[model samples]
Target: MSETTPVSELNEAEARAELARLAAQLQRANRLYHAEDAPELSDADYDALKRRNADIESLFPALKRPDSPSDQVGARAADGFSKVSHAVRMMSLGNGFDDDDIADFDRSIRKYLGLSSDAPLSYTAEPKIDGLSLSLRYEKGRLVQAATRGDGEVGENVTANARTVGDIPHDIENAPDIFEVRGEVYMSHADFDDLNARQVASGGKTFANPRNAAAGSLRQLDASITASRPLRFFAYAWGELSAPIAATQMEAIDRLRAFGFQTNDLTRLCPSLSDMLAHYRDIEAQRSTLGYDIDGVVYKVNDLALQARLGFRSTTPRWAIAHKFPAELAWTRLEGIDIQVGRTGALSPVARLHPVTVGGVVVSNATLHNEDYIAGRDAKGGAIRGGKDIRVGDWVQVYRAGDVIPKVADVDLSKRPKDSVPYAFPTKCPECGSDAIREDGDAVRRCTGGLICPAQAVEKLKHFVSRKAFDIEGLGAKQIEMFHGDPVLPINTPADIFTLQNRDASNLARLKNRDGWGETSASNLFAAIDEKRAIELGRLLFALGIRHVGEVGARDLALHYLDWDAMAQAIDAARPAALAQRKADAAEEAERQAAASDNRRARVKEARDAAIANSDVPPAAASAWSDLIGIDGIGTTLGLSLSDAFANPDERRAFDDLRQHLTIVSPDAPASDSPVAGKTVVFTGTLEKMTRAEAKARAEALGAKVSGSVSQKTDLLVAGPGAGSKAKKAADLGIETLDEDSWLQLIGDA
Candidate 1:
């Protein structure tokens, strides 16, 4: 009988008995996989068992067992290590989805600290490693025991196998008599590939990915098998200690490395939340390039003193977090594909998906990105990926990548139903009925509709009034959502936001009674909106929803242009060159489109010429279109986007109309001789009195551009608390490190 036999085929007692038996077997298998790195079953067989367990649990929810293999930890422990109890339990972090989730986590942390809403705090960030956890014990400069991080309370012993790994040191000079180090065990991509090849050659089952391979290798019942597989370790935490080692977490990591344990070289110390985000982005950009697999980054407070005060939450630490990367990839159906026009005139392809949950988010749509994404059919006439196309109703895989955007991956041709049909990618904009054209050297199809698209208008308005935009107080997301749907509000554009002042009070008075709002809040919001009738030039530029012009870009534009009128004039004048270049680029792209359109070679030339002459680049307006790129921050891509937006006569008219209603404010210019100007400071180890935010803000006030994650360019590191990985990375890179007091002295605070 198959392990997947349904519970309906057996009596309740038999089902329960089978479940118990399977649960035990699964647990043993998991122990071998996670703790010992030795697996009797293949990856496919293990997955099958796991699936069976999941099915049984779903069928008998009430009879579910607590100690099921599903509940066991993932993969294998670190190599060349011994098990040791954590000085403080190293718990995993909770995850966040959108900015709201992040904000909520921030709020909860503040509440735990008995802080008010505005109380400032600093944070450190690092990538969360996707590997097994292990504990290593050391005795007076000598190696001792290594064990898997079992249930926080008890773990299975694996000291003998751990000793065979080469990266871990057998002894350290002047080490404390007793201490435990904790770290992750993982396989590099190359090692995983080589190990899998060896397994295949030896007539053994191959591993799936590095994570699976490492897990399988670490759990072997026999020590020799583990010794044969290539494994690595990165120490991140300490368990128990005979005596005090480092004064802070950063120092602890240094001590671990000094004792000869392999640790991650990219760990960073982020003194504030903003710096932490920057670090996260840096790590994300390097994710694919990194040799080893990283599920996410781990962040720990640099101040050990603060950490000791805040301590652990239920399962994780209050002073640390695991910022995870996206990983929800599964095969589903690509039911249909459609074109969407954005406010900025960029056209994108959207896939109507057979609803699926990826990375804990329910996704029914995935972005195809551009025209280049469609058309090319695989052998099955489905979407050729890499160079493939997918058809309607084809079973396609989707993944919700780190940025929360979902995209199509592949198709299961054999499972595709006979009724499925080829998907027709639209040749025109769906929102405004404009001709969609593929530009030169471009992979996307853009709508010639420009500013008239309802979809574009609504999205733009939403962005304009967003908290980071004009920050119009009373106009929250719910309110904006209501305004988009209501005929009375008719707030369709940024200009429409100013028109809302003339709206009847009855339309908005109802909001005062809603949740999280009151008369005071509502009135305050209206007041805030009124106050922003005039805004800093940078904020207005960003609020206009210009493509690629984010906060930094806006700041640059403001710095160069000085005011809104100047900025607008520059863009208006540069429209001609932007238009000509776009047309030129479009002519080249049409060739690719022609090949994908059908197999007719003769029609390709004719289509290319005609499309170029009538490309998505609208006609430019004299000198008014030649000055947009004169500003420093404007790039070719942004210039092209702006030119496209203003090229349309209607869009130009709208821009003029919108320009009349707003007033732009100029910020005070900065002076030279600022103390912190041109200096890069990093924070490491522990800080005694001031919060990380205060330190960063003070540095900024003195004109410093504070960056997160130490690098060669990093001038100083302000360390506090459990500043582990970053300190080590900084030291390795020869970056200067500063304790909190030294930082204060350098800044003249002393």
Candidate 2:
């Protein structure tokens, strides 16, 4: 199946087939990128494939193979080098992309430590070098061995190659008798360019980038080849220290420098988050000028004691985070524009661009946002960048940062062709030719075709079987597409998926005999479908893919309504309530318009009046609307989306038809016998013994309502070390609070 195939369309057979394909593909990629240092795929493409594999596995948990790529990290150590197991593992750091993410990281740390926001917490910020990691072991103040960080637990021994590097000190003074300094092995940009120039002159292979050059140089089987290449090392951390080097991370870095090791010059100890971010910006500003390449900045808790207390997660340190710079930008020609219809019928425009490298990843497409963006106007209709509209032939800047979708940043007006014309935004559904409407306050224009729109119907069906929705085993995007496209064995809707076995059995030829399907696999698929006949109410609601009803929304609705029948009824009742409110608003607008004395006010009043009239909701429907909006986390937008989906005759009929083929089970009520049963509980900070998800799941199992924030209604607050504002709020509200250990005791898990 193509990567663009929706996850919902894949049947069990297709999912299994895809899983096997992903496994083989990722394994080869890992070997090429990690072992051979010759990656064929871009990091973005590789990540996308991995994410797709994970999503499929989530949707079909039973089909998760023993050799699943998600469970592996990097390729096994190349056979050329002797493997040296690490005494203290050199772990990677998790990433923080934006200011909010950095703030959340700090808040999370404070919460985990049970510290107030204003408490004295400091962090050491340093450039995160874009190079290979290395560990240098020293005994009796003399370098004994060096190794590359191959797979965390064990690494390839590069002692000979490391010894050739000028930055690596053969001996140290005033250092711990035994120490293992963990740092990066890198080639400076100048040195990399020089080396590449020399290689090209000598008719040898040229390196792609500095990082690859450094990695290739270090991994050379011939030590003399590494010796010829200019390599440098920067010691930032240590593993298996014989004695304490310093009390804080910054002090230790200084100690490392004193011991004849180089450290990043820009490394600074920031007293607070503001200082840290300022330092980060400063480093980012100086990044290009710096001889060595750096992708981002790493921040770690300054206090050694605090770092110890924070400890480590499975693959990364809890006390440290890498705040990456914004994605690199590149000017590329906008080839064309394509409109993609979502499950909700929202038409999103995509800018097809000439292939260009941005931050080492190839970019061929970027999101145009909406019609306003295409017309060189902001969402509010204000001119953007002097109202320079992006034309088909115009050169546009595209950017991709962290996990964000690639987006068009700006259009180069100078590069726009004289013949370029303003792109027309479609007003009709491309799939069904129905009117595509732009609702007031909505940036997107959506099709009113509902299920009749092939794009909308296909997308909705895909969403229904997605990982976060019904997650039916053996039913994935490819299978859905295949079955939906088939005239003789069509699976057009969620209900149709359930009727597949019956339809296949009635056919002259069995599905088992079809190309890519065997008797056993077909039987397994049927069994998988049968297994999902009874599903959770939340999953059922989420599967519907109502415009604004996301996973959390579905859960909130399920928690509030308890039963599918109740939720359906509430949504049905909300329609009239919403209609009634609209009518009441229209009447008020009419009075305001009549009393308006000026043209501007009259115009404003007229718009309001028009909006109210068009809404056509009766005031009597207010109660249902109120009930829906009253649900925690359910806002007016989401409430209306739910009501509208239920109110639509076509959608309601589809849902009714689907419900008949399945059993919807309500979640069990919170346990009443337990001490915290039926009480609202809020968890803050990082839990020590278990993850926050695990804690929440356990709490819900015992009948407690786990809320995201603390309030007066909260009976208890389970605070971890970095409990920060939530703990303070709980204290101020007079709600009882317990530390991780105390909460564990209360839960009888201590």
Best by TM-score: 2
- Expressed as tens digits, the lDDT of each residue in 1-750 for candidate 2 is 544444444555677898999899999997877677777765546655776687777656656888887666667788999999999987867777678799999999987776779999999999999788889999988889998776677889989999999999999888889999989989999999999999999999998888889989999999999999999989899999889999999999989899888999999999999999999999989988999989789999999988987898766789999898875678999999988777788898888888887766666777788999889898766898679887799999887654434678788887889898999999998888999998656799999989888888877887787766777777777677777868777787788888888865554246777888887887888888898899888888888878888777888778767788877876776776666554555565555545554445555566655665666565535555665775546777787778778878888888988899999988766556778787778888877776665687778778887767665557889998777998898889899989888988887888
> Tens-digit lDDT track for model 1 on 1-750?
323233323333344576788787777776665656565654434444555565555434434676665454443333534344444454545454334445566666665554567655655565677777777788887777877766554554677777877787777887778888888888899898898888889899987678777766666668899899898888888877788778777777777788788867777766556676678778889999998888666667676766776676555676776665655578777777766565556676677887776655567777666554566643333455555457777888886444334667777778777876656667777878888776555455666665577766655665677556687766744466566656655666667666665567574576477677788886776677778888888787777776777776676557555776665666766665566556655554555566677766665666556654654454444233433443333556766776665566876676677777778787544453655565666555545566555665577677555555555556666787789987887789887777777677877897
Top candidate, metric lDDT: 2
TM-score of each: 0.48, 0.71
lDDT of 2 at 599: 42
TM-score of 1: 0.48
Which residues of candidate 1, in runs, are more than 4 Å off? Answer: 1-171, 174-182, 185-333, 338-367, 377-388, 397-407, 414-421, 485-487, 503-525, 583-633, 674-750
RMSD of each: 17.6, 7.4
